[model samples]
Target: MPSEHESFNTRMAKAMNDRDFQAYEALLTDDYVGEYPQSGEVIHGPKNARAIIEYYPGTLPRDTLDLKSARVGATEARWVRTPTFTVVRAEGTGNVGFSAMQSRYPDGSTWWVINFYELRGGRLARSTTYFAPLFEAPEWRKPYVEQRGPTADR
Candidate 1:
């Protein structure tokens, strides 16, 4: 059985992977805030956070379910989209949580994303996310380090 913290992380990961904005919003506190330091953007409130994803230019992947069908209450299980993000890992203790993810974009690029979260009353009160494109390790560093696979434990 998953611990309370693990369950919370699982719910968060599921909401993000499904892009269920309504569900995502429900996981956040009314005063929730998120920051993207790379872009110098700050999202205030759950509604605005949802808007950021909903209105992102060409970012939303096309769902397998037809738009008309979706509007008619088609099951989400029938929905499919490409370039979805995968939660590499998530863990939490007390009021602090952390998640690492790998995102593949439609442009054939992959990026690593990390989010540090602060929870209040079991809902996200603050988050800071950082995104970085995957890059090949420099040959010079090979001698000094051991390569770790995706599932390698910290």
Candidate 2:
């Protein structure tokens, strides 16, 4: 069973993955700011945040049925939607939190997103996020590292 208590990052991940703008907005402060350093873009407030989500391009045309291992209690279910994003890791202390996420694009490519969050008055005050596409490790480093776990195939 999932815990009754969830960290800020965990809730943020669920809100983002579900594309629940209302829940996302509730997590932020009135003066919330978000930055994307790669594009030198900055979002000043929740209104812009909603605009960004509404304007994001290339969403999946429709959700697919989950043909594998989706169950409710002991019964199989096929209507569940596959998650487009996964929170690989997240942690926080005091008023600071950070999360690493894996995002799957409509182009069939995967990217990593790292987010640094700051909280004030128990809500998000600022965020800095970075995005980078997945790449194969250079052959030169083959001897120095070991392939491990689920990510080994990537």
Rate residue 151 of model 1 by lDDT: 27
The sequence of per-residue lDDT tens digits that candidate 2 reaches over residues 104-139 is: 654556789899988888678999999988877677
lDDT (Cα) of model 2: 0.68
lDDT of 1 by residue, 111-137 (tens): 788999899998889999999887767
RMSD of each: 6.6, 7.3
Best by TM-score: 1
Error of 2 at 141 (Å): 0.7
TM for every model, in the order presented, reads 0.75, 0.74
Weakest 10 consecutive residues of candidate 2 by summed lDDT: 66-75
Candidate 1 lDDT for residue 38: 93
In TM-score terms, candidate 1 sits at: 0.75
lDDT for position 118 in model 1: 91
